[model samples]
Target chain A: MTDISRDDVQHLAQLSSLALSDQEVDNLRIDIGNILGYINQLSELDTTGVEPTYQVTDLENVWREDKIDDYGLGRDDLLALAPESKDGQIKVPKVL
Target chain B: MTKISDYISKNARQNVLEAIKRANDKNEYHALLSFTEARALERADAVDRGEITGRLAGVPFVVKDNFFAFGAPTTAASRMLEHFQAPLQATAVEKLEAEGAICIGKANLDAFAHGGSTENSAFGPTLNAFDKTKVAGGSSGGSAVVTALDIVPFALGSDTGGSIRQPASFNGVVGVKPTYGTVSRYGVVAMASSTDTIGCFATDAADAELIMDIMAGKDNKDMTTLPDFFKPTNVKPGLKIGLIKETTTDDVDPEVKQATLDYVARLKAAGHQVDEVTMPISKYALAIYYIVVPAEVSSNLARYDGIRYGHRAEGVATLAELYGKSRDEGFVAENKRRIMIGSYVLSSGFFDAYYLQAQKVRTLLINEFNKLFEDYDVLLGPTTPTPAFGLGENTADPIKMYLADIMTVPASLAGLPAISVPVGKSSNGLPIGVQLVGQRRSDADLLALAKSMEKA
Candidate 1:
């Protein structure tokens, strides 16, 4: 079994940009640990010299014209989806 | 057992109204999230006035809530997007609309298309269409149930792993997961982009075929989409099919195995050659999927950091707090579990061991499939190891829940086209499904074969 510590879970949460509660961190510690243990079974396979498959489509570097097509959605329409907007731009908490 | 033809002969308004009424009647199942009544009625009136006409011609349908459609908010069954409306319709939805298909409502799903059952839905679990005590297999659970209940002839679903196929199996419907890139993913909520494919659920294979034919095409908006290679073909005679030996082992439920063999027998009656073929690497597919998918999922979900759209947390002083708190509030437990797992695997020290190793193993798994396809036109297996499990039966243990996808994930990891067709029921009376997997670009053939054997 994977010995995923509470701190390990917290570090993962930080990496994932998630502010987990003490209870969540405790629960996820066990849950994520079990998941890792299950997925670790992949190591049993002998994949020596096997090339990794990143994407299934044989197509590569599919280039398209740089023409901007918003599919009929206008700026206001997109801005309308944002949680907060001001002065025709998205508003966010002040970045340090 | 509704069909596209049922609505084709009726006025668009009548079809749309009837579908809406059925959806409301079956509300206890929690298959639907919200109705697009106003937009549907307006579109129905247009079709009645002869302004809209096509093959589907006013046939009503439902989309899994993950899709961006007009009338309702496109929540991916999560609190994050609960009230978030899509700026544009998904290309798949647009294509269906072009064929005069009216979308009456959005169906429920596992939050962010994660988990094997709709039990993970943030709103609530969608009840199985067959027995409310059992779960609706997911994350396409709601779409499958709506079709099974005959609320609509067909519905759209996206399959990243076993989302569409497993649910369709549980609900006794036809589900299609086209070869990777068969349909554009644009306007659909992205989940593990490498494996995500837009597909549909239907009462029968023919409706699934027509829906796939219409939605299968290239879109400049999504570069991963293949140049439309899907052309429906009649099943070739005396086809050689491989019944995967790994899937029918003693560990699988006896009823599920019997149903799969029964389907194979029907193939034999139709003069197709069925052989038990070995693919040992199939055992490791779920492990590889768990690693690679979550890694991709973590990256894909990073876009939901609360600044641009979706949910936001108030009372956060710093930008980091805003990002963290909002995400913590917006996402459900399963979402967090996947994201953290993804983070752990993709982090610097573990990247090579977990993520890269899984990818290499994935290649090995696909190679085994390719080798088998050389002798077999298609591979057959049970869609799930068992029938629909009781609600919350495996929810407490995440690994137990993940095992439900063991049979279907191999085809998904290989980016192959696979379909699940309802065969028979277990002694306990739960529906069982047999899955047919074809090589990439053989989406049309897979459906054709399933369609031909529909009666049997």
Candidate 2:
């Protein structure tokens, strides 16, 4: 069984961009360990020369006319859904 | 259960009012999140006045809250979008509405459709329609319960893995998880993109067929959709069917096994050939699903970073903190667990060992299904390992909850069209569904076979 460490859990939370509480992190450490252990059973299979099936649909490069379509929603309608919008634009925390 | 014809044949306004009253009376199940009373009434009135004219005129229905719908917020049963009203309606909902189907309310689900049981919903779990003590199978639990309770003739649901079929089995209704790309996914919340499918729950297979036909077709908005191909066909007699041996092992509930065998007997009585078939690679489908699905889930759910639409964290100074804290506050624990697992497997060091390996194994699984389909018209099995469990039964163990999907995920992984048809009930009086799986794009034939099995 693969045992996930507390630090590993924190790193995963970081990668996922989630600010998990210590309690959540602790609980997830055990849960992720057990789940990994279960899924680890797949390692027993030898998958030599098997092409990975990324998608089941047998279509490729489905092209459309390069035209703009709003899909029935206007800019203001979507902007209104944001947490903070001002002067016809959405406001977010400064990246730097 | 109320029939589609029953709704359409009655006065449109009266149908909407009665359906709303039924939804209100069934509050103990907690099946619906919010009622779209005003919109539904106006639509019904339009139908009555001939302003709306179509096949489904005045038919009241429900959508799993994950769809972008009007009249109520598309919550996806999470606090993140608890107040996020949709800017545009989902294509599936719009199509249904075009046919004059009135969406009376939005249904409950596992928050972000991550968990097997609706217990993971930020709102309380939807109780089983048959037995209040047991769970309503989910993440389409509310849709199934509403249909089972006769609150509506039908309801729309999304299936990524066993979300639709598992709950339909638990609730004793016909649930259709159409072939991948069979229906346009525009306007629906994205889950595992490759496996996500739009389906519906109905009291009978014919009703399900009608709903699916109306919704099936390509939309320019969703490029993954296939051209129109879902025309219902009449299933011929003497069909060859495979009864999957793995689905009825000793580990499965005895009553569930019996229910499957009973359905097989009915198939034989109807002059169809049923043979026991084995697909060894299917044993790994659940593991592959957990890996591949979470990988996709991790990527798809990244859009909910509290920037544009969903709940935003207050008092977070840095941009990183805003993303982290808003997500932490918005998603349920199950959603976070899936996201982290996805992150773990998708990380560079583990990518080949986990995600890529699972995809390869997924190919092997699909190959096995294809080989079986060569000789069998369809694969038959019990939709779930057991009947509806108690509300808190599998909550403490995520693996146990995932096990509820074991019988249904193989088809999902392979992008096959599988339907769960109500066969009978358990000794405990809970519903048991028998699943029929068909090869890709065989949705029409699959529904034909299911419609043939209805009790005369």
Candidate 3:
């Protein structure tokens, strides 16, 4: 079984953009280990030449008319859903 | 069963009012999060006054909270979207409303439809309709319970893995997880992009078929939707049925196995042929599902970064802290576990070993199902390994909780339509369901087979 360390858990939390607490990281360390061990059973399958099945709609490069489609959603309505909005734009933390 | 016609025949106002009362009375079960009483009553009055006219006029239903509808926020039982009012309603809800079906309330679910049990819900777990001690199997537990409790004749739910089917089994209702693209996913909380399907739970097979028919069709908003193909038909005799060898193993609860076997016997008695078929890759389907689904989940859920809608962190100066803290606060433990696992599998070094390999095995699983479909019109099995378990039984172990979906994920991976039909009760009086899996686009025929059994 693959044992996930606290550091490993932290790394994953960082990757997922989740600021997990020490207790949460501790809990996830064990749970992630068990889940990884469970899914590790897939290593036995020999899928050498098999192609990956991504989307299953059975359609290829479905295209629509090259035009703007608002889907009946107005800009002001969507912008209003944000936590903070400026003049026609969403406000965010300053990035250096 | 309170059929749709029953609601239409009765005074629309009284029908909806009584249903809302019954649902409110069953508050201990926690089947519904909030009632859309004002909207529902308004629509009921309109229907009574002949303002609205359609197939499902005056019928009341419930939507799992993941779907966007008016009157209540689409919480998905998560703190993130707990107060996020939907700007638009799900296409499925719109369709039902177009047919005059009134959505009376929003049902509870596992946070973002993450766990098999609604224990992962931020608010609280929905109790089983039969026994309060046992879990109402989820992530669509509330929909199943509402239907089982007769609060509504039918309720809408979204099934990614076995969310609808497993919960239906636990609560003893007919639940359909239609072909992946049969219903549009627009305005529905995204889980796993590839497998998320819109379906419903109903008291009977004919009602299930009616609900599915209304919900199935293409929508331009969701590009993944398939063309309209669902049509109800009489069950044709002499259909070839495959009894899956994997689901009836000794490890499965004896009662569940027996329920499946009893359903098989009924199938034979109804002049259908049954044969044991082996799809060896089904043994590995759970493993492949965990990898592929989480990868999709991680990608899909990335949208909840405290930027647009939903929850945001308080007093965080830096952008990084804001994103991180808001997400950590918003998501339940299961959501983080899945996202982290997805990050690991889809990470640079492990991509080929985990994500790509799982996808490859997925293709193989689909191939095995295709080969088996050549011989059988439908495949039969136990919907779950066991009956509804105690509320806290599997919550401690994520792996144990995942085992609840082992028998149902193969169909999801292959994008096939499957349904859970309540067969009988276990020794303890808990419901036992037998699953019917059909080939792609064979959803109508599958419902017909279950309906034929009901008539018999």
Candidate 4:
């Protein structure tokens, strides 16, 4: 059985850029450990010389016109979806 | 009476009203997030006035809220996009609208389509159509319930890992997960990119075919869409069918296996050969799905930072805090579970061990399916290991919740077309659906085979 420590959970949250609470981290430490243990069963099978599939479409070199097409949405329409906007620009919290 | 043909003959406004009224009637089920009554009425009036006339004229339907349609906000049943109304409709929804289908409501789902059960929905869980105490199989639970309850003839859903099919199985409805790229994914919330396909839920296979015919085709907006290849065909008998030996093991419920065997017998009585076949790699497919899906999800969900559309943190002075807090608050527990697992697999140290290994095994799975399809026309299995469990049955353990997807995920990892069709019921009276998985573009053929079962 693989045991994921609290520190590992915290580090993973950092890598994922998620700010997990103390309770969340504690719960996830156990759950992620169980999941990783389950997934580790994949090592049982040998995948010698097998090619990895990234996407299933089997198509390559997909090219389209390099021109700008907004797909029919106006600037205001997009801005309306944001929480804060000013001067025709989306507003975010001040960066340190 | 709510079938597409029935709606075609009825006054459009009346049909829309009846569905909305039914939605109101079944409010406790929490199937629909928002009923677009006003918009539906307006569209229905247009169809009645002869301004809108198409194959599915005035047929009211529902969409899983992940679809970026205009009538309501596409919550994706997540707090992140709770208020983030879409600027444009999904291409699949647009095609359905062009056929004069009026979308009256947005259905519930697992937040970001994460969990197998709707318990992860930020709103609330949708009770099963059969027993209120049981779960509505998810993340397409609401779509399945609305169809089973006859609120609408059909509804749209996205199947990433049997999100459409399993729920349809639980609710005794028809769910289709078309071959990857069979329908355009534009404007739909992205989950696992390689396996996510837009499909529908309906009361019968023929209605599903009509909806698939309208939605299936190439879309310039979504480059992966195949050139229109879907055509309705009457079921042709004498095709070779294989019963997956792996799915009928001791771990599966007896009633579920009996239902599948009963369906296989029906196929045989109708003059087709049925035999047990083995695909050993499927036992590892679920593990591979967890690894590959989380990797894709972590990357796909990376776009939901606070900067653009979606929820933003209320009190964060730094940009990193803003992103971290908003994401931490927006995603549900299972979503975070998958994301962090994704981070673990894709991280530099673990890359070769986890992600790369899973991908290689994925190829083996696809090859196994390919080899099986070389001899068999389609493969059959129980859509789920068991019938619908209670709402809180698998919620405590994320792995337990994921087990609901095991029988359904092997076909998904292969990017094949599969459907869940209701065969019989459990002794407890819950619905059971048998799955038919076909080769990559043989979607219409699979549906035809399932439809033929009705005649049998």
Instruction: In angstroms, give how far residue B381 of model 4 lies from its true place.
Output: 0.8
lDDT of 1 by residue, B1-456 (tens): 878888895889999998998888889999999999999999999999999989888899999999999999999999999999888999999999998989999999999999889998999999999899999999999999999999999999999999999999999999999999999999999999899999999999898999999999999889999988999888888999999999999999998998899889999999999999999888899899999999999999999999889999988989899999999999999999999899999999999999999999989999999999989999999999999999989989999999999999999899999999999999878999999999999989899899899865
Model 1 pairs whose backbones collide: none
Query: What tens digits encode model 3's per-residue C-alpha lDDT throughout B167-258?
Result: 99999999999998999999999999999999999989999999998999989889899888999998988999999999999999998999
Query: What is the i-RMS of every prediction?
Result: 1.0, 1.1, 1.2, 0.9
The backbone clash count of each candidate, in order, is 0, 0, 0, 0
Local accuracy of candidate 3 as per-residue lDDT tens digits, A1-96: 589789999999899999999999999999899999999999998988899999777767667788888877899989888888999998887744
The TM-score each candidate achieves on chain A is: 0.90, 0.92, 0.90, 0.91
Model 4 misplaced regions, further than 4 Å: none
Per-residue lDDT of B1-456 in model 2, one digit per residue for the tens? 778998876788898899889988889899999999999888888899999989899899999999998999999999999999899899999999999999999999999998787999999999999999999999999999999999899999999999999999999999999999999888899999999999999999999999999999999999999888999888888999999999989999999999899889989999999999998888899999999999999999999989999999998879889999999999999999899989999999899999999999999999899899889999999999999999899999999999999988999999999999998898889999999999999999999999888853
The segments of candidate 2 whose C-alpha lies over 4 angstroms from its true place after superposition are none
Model 2 gets an lDDT of 0.93
In model 1, state the lDDT of residue B357: 98
Give, for candidate 3 chain B, the lowest lDDT window spanning 10 residues: B1-10
Clashing residue pairs in candidate 3 are none
lDDT of 1: 0.93
Chain B fold agreement for model 4, TM-score: 0.99
